[model samples]
Target chain A: MANITNDAAKPERLQLLRVLGPAHVWALGVGIVLVGEYMGWNFAVGKGGMIAGLVACWVAGLLYTCVAMIDSEVTSTVAAAGGQYAQAKHIVGPLMAFNVGLFLVMAYTMLEAANAITVGFLLDTVAGMTGHSGLHQQPFIVLAIMFLAWLNYRGVLATLTFNLVIVAVAFTAICVLFFAIQFGASNVPLDFSAVTEEPLPYGWLGIVASLHFGLWYYLGIEGTCQAAEEVRSPARSLPYGTMAGIMTLLIAATLTWYMCSGLIPWEYLGQAGTPLFDAARVTGNVWLMVLLFIGTIFATLASANGCINDASRAWFSMGRDRYLPSWFGAVHPVYRTPYRSIVFLVPIALIFALGAPLDQVVTFSILSGLLGYTFMTFNMVMFRRKWPLDTIKRGYVHPFHPLPTIILLILCSSAFFAVFLGYGTQLIAMMCFYIIASLWFHFRRYQYVRRGDQFTMPWPRPQGY
Target chain B: MAYEPKKQGLAAQIFDVVTLLVLTVGALYVPLYMGLAGAAKTPNPIENPTWEALGQNAAEQRQWEALGITDPASVNDMITARFDYSFSWAALIIMIVSVVGYFVLVVRLSDREYREVLDERFGSKRKGG
Candidate 1:
């Protein structure tokens, strides 16, 4: 644990270790990465989707992990709470940092909005059973946001511990459902024929298609590092939690999903509106369906709760840095929660829920986050080569420094390529947004700067040898 | 066009609901309108040529001649004879291009923000200022 009073030892902000631990943080990672999207990836993409997604994930994963790893060295690294904002200050200076910080606030807030909508989606399912009308009414949003806000106002450690309990119960229910699906297999034909006879529906294009769904598994990864100060042994835990959640779910979830697809028959799997839920219903055991409902609801709940908590932190950090209003920086004096920041995201979340369709929100959030992952990969490479290091030198070294780093760079680049190849103009439009913002900030940050003088791009991050 | 998340306030919500309704309608209605209906129970591919011949080949012949096209209405009887087998394929293509296209767009925009975050997260540590 860090000594809070020893300001002279390392003064600017509070250290991260006081708040989180390896196990708890890993759960946070798991909470975000494990979701319906993983199931979609498995069923839709099939075997080939797994190969391509995993390969891309491996590449991008290293880059993301490297970002967290290099971060271990900073006493109070950039600015307290303003993650990328602080990192930007190091590499590009205040203007770029200011722009990036604003971008992050938008990104995380949108994510919060999307997750709140997800809460409505899950609850809407509950509403279906009771014949309730318009559960998505404004009152529900008020209730959900306020509840989440209250949960957060309780403080970081408490919020995490509460989430952990919720997540644990969720996982236990998930285990029961998994077993039911596996056991209900009356026709457990161990034949590997499905891969050959029909072969995954989309063929080559399927792999690229799968990335859309598959990438969702990696969405919550960045959140884990947001509380670097709260974590127990961040040097070790951050890396472990971030990557483990990804790799484990990749392997475990993939196998389980494959089992479902292979065993369930393509027609049934494809047709079921709620495939997992439908699968449970077919088991001839009402008990199993009940269990699956529990699993799915909890999955959505954990996602919503965990996302709101992290979203507030991102806001608080940004606010504390004076990038946004200083009001965003407020922490509950008693609970040490980001009260103002968390409260602020509420209506934005409601509007998001009320406005956008569900699938778009999910896909949009994942896409935006993966873009972040690509940059992280490049950062890892640059950090290894260009970033300066002192107190924290070697955290988690990429197995092959330059090569893996290079591969990660390519992989991250591919995320851009994948999105564009898969999306085309929409991708272009999205980039134009940031480009417009980036340019606005650039011109505003540096008045009357010529294109020739714009040769230099941002500043430094660390690497391990 | 430069894409912003919401064009205006209430308009955004209206657009969202409208877009979703259209997409869902398309997803559902397209298949019904075009998807192969009443696929004459395709028997498992078997070694028996007579059974196979009795199925598609014989059925295809009926499709052309049954319309009394002995003189063949200008176009090749074979062309019309060819069963309209591509409706389902076309429908599948549209559905896929749509769902995947929708998300890919979302992911790309998300990536832009994500990348900047990564740069700053790391950039902060490098300078140590």
Candidate 2:
């Protein structure tokens, strides 16, 4: 056996600045999931009534809590830009890491595309209300994608600052909506009957049907982890920031669900393209509606911009690791951002925004996200085995050791199966995508390994082979 | 450092091209075709205003009734049932299996013997590698 040094591994040349603090991490984390307050989440009420939707969200919150805690441990320990991809490479192997990277890229890009399309939908709805039409969704979506990609390419600081401002405004709007529903003067009084209305009006299967929309509440909370390399004192900041963000999202999800449904008929809210806007409209407060409208636009922009940042990071990581073309790994010499990766992502996102229905796009995003969660949870155990607590500089270890990971594995697997059962054909289409991706991986692996490149774990390796 | 392009054999090149084509067609063309076909089967409101208006009115009336509202023209609506029992049962079964499987994995992996074996195989050989 011969000893190997840390210098043997290639030095990181695609450098990203470590400028993000706890506040930035929290804002980005919450901002990525803030879209839940505006739209998509109401679709859960369409499947399950108000009470059932709330219950579904509660279950989804539990799943995300487990995922966030476990992910924070790995993010702090690994402190890499790839997030789950980097974690998986050390715990599992290259093949599984490739699949994880693809899943994350798909999830983030599809989410961005969905947010862009939803912006178009909102604009068209607003236009229709004014007795005008022909908003041309494709052009709007393309412009949104291009704008977000450009913002991301400029630099991470610019992106994070923009995210913080929008998140604050959007969150304040949600808080105002909650207050308006409780005390604002309106012709129709707030109804509490929906809260106790049979809980599961559609039966237990309604829970399964609602899982995807329920997941929207915390869909992109993991985006913070993808920015691991850029966070100062990641070991301390990742856990505190991400966990705070999850708690905030959980409260927002509950309040948004209750206020919107309680103020209007749950069915009307479910069918609304922008439920929060409708909730404000039902209050008969023109000012409230206008405020929420602005919030909706900003929320969409924030979520889309955040997804672009996270997705490009995943693409950049895979390219750096040689999972994809090396061109994707190129960073802007001036801005020190993953410019080529952002450019590569924009067109694909634009295509999705134009081609797919918002429902299908959102479902695909959640499905891919849950797939990534499954890998991350499994990797948590593998990471603990590879690097015991005593062996590493552990800042935050999840309480109860592996129980949370096991429980999360159960929840994520079930959610994946539920998505499959609810959306069989669409899930099949995504499976076809994975097949194609795996085929590409199979061929790429030959060249990748022939070049004598492999994933390097942060932990020490045994003397070798 | 500038990236050096890798040379590939003819067979590998052909395989890559074929897979790329298949992926492009499957991802782009099939979904687009399906969406267009589905859209074509639906009636356009512009072409049949009277029928569409009648259908819309009837839906509005039903929705008003479901909400327990007195006015038939009320915009407020109530949620209705949309569930599949088979899906619920399947999801439940999968969840149960996953929980049990994960528990067993945790128990096995956390064992002292297993840790020792893993340490011997992959743990650092010296103070630092």
DockQ of each candidate, alpha-carbon based: 0.04, 0.13
**Residue A91 alpha-carbon offset, candidate 2, angstroms:** 1.3
Model 2: per-residue Cα lDDT over A276-386, one tens digit each:
887776666678878989999999999999899998988888767656655456667778798888887787788778887777788778878887887777678777876
Off by over 4 Å in 1: A1-17, A36-85, A91-111, A123-142, A185-194, A263-275, A388-395, A444-465, B1-129
Q: What is the lDDT of candidate 2?
A: 0.70
- Writing each residue's lDDT as its tens digit, candidate 1 over A49-97 gives 3344444344434544554444433212332344454444443344444
TM-score of each: 0.65, 0.82
The residue-level lDDT of candidate 1 at A90 comes to 40
Report how far residue A70 has shifted in candidate 2, in Å: 0.3
Every candidate's chain B TM-score: 0.33, 0.26
Residue B79, model 1, lDDT: 22
**lDDT at A169, model 2:** 96
Highest TM-score scorer: 2
Leading candidate by DockQ: 2
